[model samples]
Target: MDHDLALIVGLVLIILSIPSIIAAFSDGHAPRVAAFTIIAGGALLVWAISSKPGGYTISDVPDTFVRVVARYLP
Candidate 1:
């Protein structure tokens, strides 16, 4: 994957995890779900960092946008 894409993905994951982390702290019933979200988000971020290919390319593709949308809607 392109480095730019990877960075975008990682940013997306970190962004997604923010709400989950907040929910985990504010709600009782959502802790488990929140925890899972946080873990999954972290994993995705790590994967993006480790999987990025050589020199990054700049693009306007929607991978991160889609991932963020999916995280909120799913």
Candidate 2:
């Protein structure tokens, strides 16, 4: 996938895992799925950043998310 798409997916996965992690903690269970999700998300983020020239910055994330969403949506 392109850098923008990868970035968005990685961020989304990480964001989504937060709730699962919280729920697991509240239930006193292991956050195995959440941990895996975080790992996958981190891997995607690393790949996207390393593959892209000049890399990305905090200021660029909003634009990247908008660009990826617009490209996929009708």
- lDDT for 72 in candidate 1 is 56
TM-score of 2: 0.98
Cα RMSD of predicted structure 2: 0.4
lDDT of every model, 2 decimals: 0.60, 0.97
The TM-score values for the models, in the order shown, are 0.44, 0.98
Predicted model with the maximum lDDT = 2
Superposition error at 30 for model 2 (Å): 0.2
lDDT score of model 1?
Answer: 0.60
Lowest lDDT 10-mer window, candidate 1? 52-61
**Candidate 1: residue 67 Cα off by (Å):** 12
lDDT of 1 by residue, 1-74 (tens): 54445556656666776777777777655567656765666665567655765422344336555665666575
